[model samples]
Target: MLIEVEVCDVCRRLGVPVTSYTITETESGRSVVTVRCGEHAAPFEEVLGQPVEAVAAAETPKPRQAKKAATGRQPRGQRAERQVMTREQIDAAKAAGKA
Candidate 1:
């Protein structure tokens, strides 16, 4: 038996994972593709002169998100908008020498 199997349109276009394939043997003596799901039953005929069955099952890889840029510098703006530190706070920090 000779059959042609390709990536299903729904699976390819809609980005659906083709973990399982739904095949129906029609009266026309040709295998027709119906759908592809996450899992399916088997009775698949290995067609002659066709590509070997895929060893790896279809699965949707996890989507990757782009990383954000690091920021260490302060934004440019008016100095008046910045809060003023108290003299006591500055003195205490200087005395402790932590900053």
Candidate 2:
């Protein structure tokens, strides 16, 4: 038979098993681990001095709108074509005062 052991340092005082925990390291190469039950897990945010839920929500990306695909159909307006004019036709129109 195998037996489970609860060695959470934080919950040892309360005699509770650790279900959640947060481990942090300081600048001096010292590491600190805090183990707590589900109810006490929220208090870990006090170490960072901010609401952990708000931070997590803010960092999550919102869903984006789906992009529309091209239908391959031309637009409703008529396509315009360019007319090439020659110098002689221009001069004739100007001489006839039709320009």
TM-score of each: 0.20, 0.30
lDDT score, residue 30, model 2? 69
Give the CA lDDT, 0 to 100, for residue 31 in model 2: 63
What digit string (tens of lDDT, one per residue) describes model 2 on residues 40-92?
66556454566779777767999999755447754555454766779999899
Number of clashes in every candidate structure? 0, 0
lDDT of each: 0.49, 0.65
lDDT value, residue 15 of candidate 2: 57
Name the top lDDT candidate: 2
In angstroms, give how far residue 32 of model 2 lies from its true place: 2.7
What tens digits encode model 1's per-residue C-alpha lDDT throughout 15-89?
444444445555666665555433322223323233444422223356899755447644454233666789998
- Residue 42, candidate 1: C-alpha displacement in angstroms: 80
> What 10-residue stretch in candidate 2 is worst by lDDT?
7-16
